[model samples]
Target: MCSDFEPLGKSSLFTILDACKASTRKSLQGINYFAAEAGEAFDGIRKMIEDKVALHNDSARLIENLKRARFYLKSDYKVHVARSSNIADHCCVYALSDPEKRDFAQDCDHEHNESCAECSNLTRTLNEIERLLEETEEDEELLHRTLKKFRSYREAIEAWKAHLLRSINQDLCRENLLDKLSNDEIYLNLDWAMKFLPIKSREPQSEFFGKRGI
Candidate 1:
């Protein structure tokens, strides 16, 4: 099975999480008897801790906003048919987000036979979903299962967004770029690109995803 962690492109939440863990661990390990008095000696460690907190808070806030927006990939979507109703509705795949928001599935088959690898993989995924439905004893259980899977999907989306935002922010960080924006608030907002970026900048960032679809 493919691993869920770090599945998206570079500089995603996994890096932030790893940095936070390492910083916390190093802080504990580097504790010194003179730390209370050794101000400069503790400065680097203190900055690391503060950086971790800022990164974590930024990532977490963006994730929460995305969950509220029902933002997710097309592949992460699914349709569940009820026993009483023949029609199935597609659902948004982000964890704890509204399930009613959905996109129709895109087809990829043409001349593939049943034995084809892609076809087989698709069949297995569908079968597993069916199995999960069969095992679900209550309506609440079904929703719980979907939310759990969607949480993973959300992380993947966040990772891709982070990667795209970093590319955009690289240019935005130049001193002249802030002058072009003409506002300190907008300049500061670029620090957390996805969450606080202005609409004019956000257009290109979103278009990045529109073209790549990842």
Candidate 2:
């Protein structure tokens, strides 16, 4: 995600890139060991759910539970992104503490579990659907539907990450260009504007007023 800072010069670009690197590093590696563990703990639950769905494709109740779990898991990821700056705030303490024991996925092994943490805090689920065989999924259409949704979700996440990185790269390119500029040379950044209209002396009022159309 682009931060509030804008790069106006090489020095500014350096600072912006440094901050972006730090933010990405922290987000991926986590602020502390516990935070990273929370993410891994969530992945374990997701994998466990996938295993259950594979083993018991005929269980409709289990499928429904998986559906509900999907909703909770996706919502948890969104909340985590929104609250990335403050993980402990606006999140369930239980989910934050010893997240390995939060087996919401296993809870769905039999039936839909209605109870969740007060804030419904869970970890961000990653893409690990490679183990699923197409033939097995074909046997259960509902299972395929659930997995498709997860696949789409993961694709969207990857796309966003790509876009953020692309934007950072563009800024870095601009910085490089500026760095090569000679002392006498100047850089002009042109931004999009409304259509240009040629001004004429004593133009008609109607023509002058309607000359520009965006």
Candidate 3:
């Protein structure tokens, strides 16, 4: 599988694997992370593969092989994906500005600021859906499922955007409070870690099936 991907650059490999994962309703949180040019280079390849699979007598075998490839390759591929997604040299205007009002820029030289948006998951997911929609143009069931998954992600992002706006509003309120504070009186702020780990133990047999993480 690695040899098959060797001829394609890292970005094309990234797109193929991500597109497969997207079809499975996986979150495209880390993709094209180390790719020099993470453009849609392998789109034609995907279409060709889909066509061959359609015309092949053993279509199930081809699809099964693809499923296995995705499962096995992802663990190895994630290192590059994580690196590429996490490291954005530019001030990710994506992260610094309002999510709703953010503009996609070609060249941004501003100093990098930490932002969840810099991960570029949402952007990639949006693009993947467009491709998925095109690829599944003839398959109504697949199209419906793809749209369903997209709507779920869209709802989640919308909620996060609303939360971010409220946080900005709170920050403005805090600034006004700070302006009114006296020299003797100080405003105290408390920070807490809100991160959690997903832990599972002694799970039932039914838990092993359907929409599970690899």
Candidate 4:
């Protein structure tokens, strides 16, 4: 009833990205309401308002990107890792072995010299994919850390707002910049994990235990 070679999953990347765009646009509307009333008189207040708006926008954007990437890492990139690892990697392993005795699947044409385009392409593709995945791993870690900081800073921001509201001058238009966040109480340590990674087999290592040994 179904085809043998089906796509791994539906392409929901565009749908997720569209939702991100819509939400980001809606959030920016908050900044428009607080535009400086008297131009130069309340520049500091305006700057603070814009900064708060920017933080919200930037945080939302980073979270959306992470979300989208996480989806791809689970779906599309997972498929890519599965497919790219099959024939080419087997051929590569064969090639690295004895040139004369080595054998690969007949269709796996890694027998060509390094100058061959097909050979070069397959070689570079795996390397580049691993490199890119490593970088993505680092980036995702940083994004997670930023999210934690935003959570911790929420309390500081709320306290700052409450204190400022009680001041004789509640208008922000006249301020230059809000004070830097000093409260670093909330700390989060995230366990790092790679959402997109090669599905390497443990069989090779497991075979060692099967051998006759003490």
TM-scores of the candidates are: 0.19, 0.31, 0.30, 0.18
Clashes of 4: 7
Candidate 3 Cα misplacement greater than 4 A, ranges: 1-128, 183-214
lDDT of 4 by residue, 1-214 (tens): 5668764344676776667775432221112211111111123222322344334434344334334433432244323321112433222333234445535222343343224333234234323433433444446775465445433333332332223232313222223223432485443446543232222222222232333322
Higher-ranked by lDDT: 2 or 3: 2
- Local accuracy of candidate 1 as per-residue lDDT tens digits, 107-193: 222322223233233334334433433444356775576546534443443344333333333443465566677444574443322
Candidate 4 CA-lDDT value: 0.34
lDDT for each of the candidates?
A: 0.34, 0.43, 0.43, 0.34
Rank order by TM-score, top first?
2, 3, 1, 4
Of models 2 and 3, which has the larger TM-score?
2
Task: Give the better candidate number (1 or 3) by TM-score.
Answer: 3
Lowest lDDT block of 10, candidate 2: 24-33
Clashing residue pairs found in predicted model 4: 42-173, 42-174, 43-173, 44-175, 44-176, 45-172, 45-175
Q: Which residue pairs does candidate 2 place in steric collision?
A: none
Name the 10 consecutive residues with the lowest summed lDDT in model 4: 29-38
Better model by lDDT: candidate 1 vs candidate 2? 2
- Backbone clashes in candidate 1 total 0
Give lDDT tens digits, candidate 2, residues 1-214: 5898764999888988888785431122211333233333434445545566464553454334445544544355344422112333222222224546654312211322343342232222142232443435665776676567555544543443333333444665688899999999998999854453455322223344444543
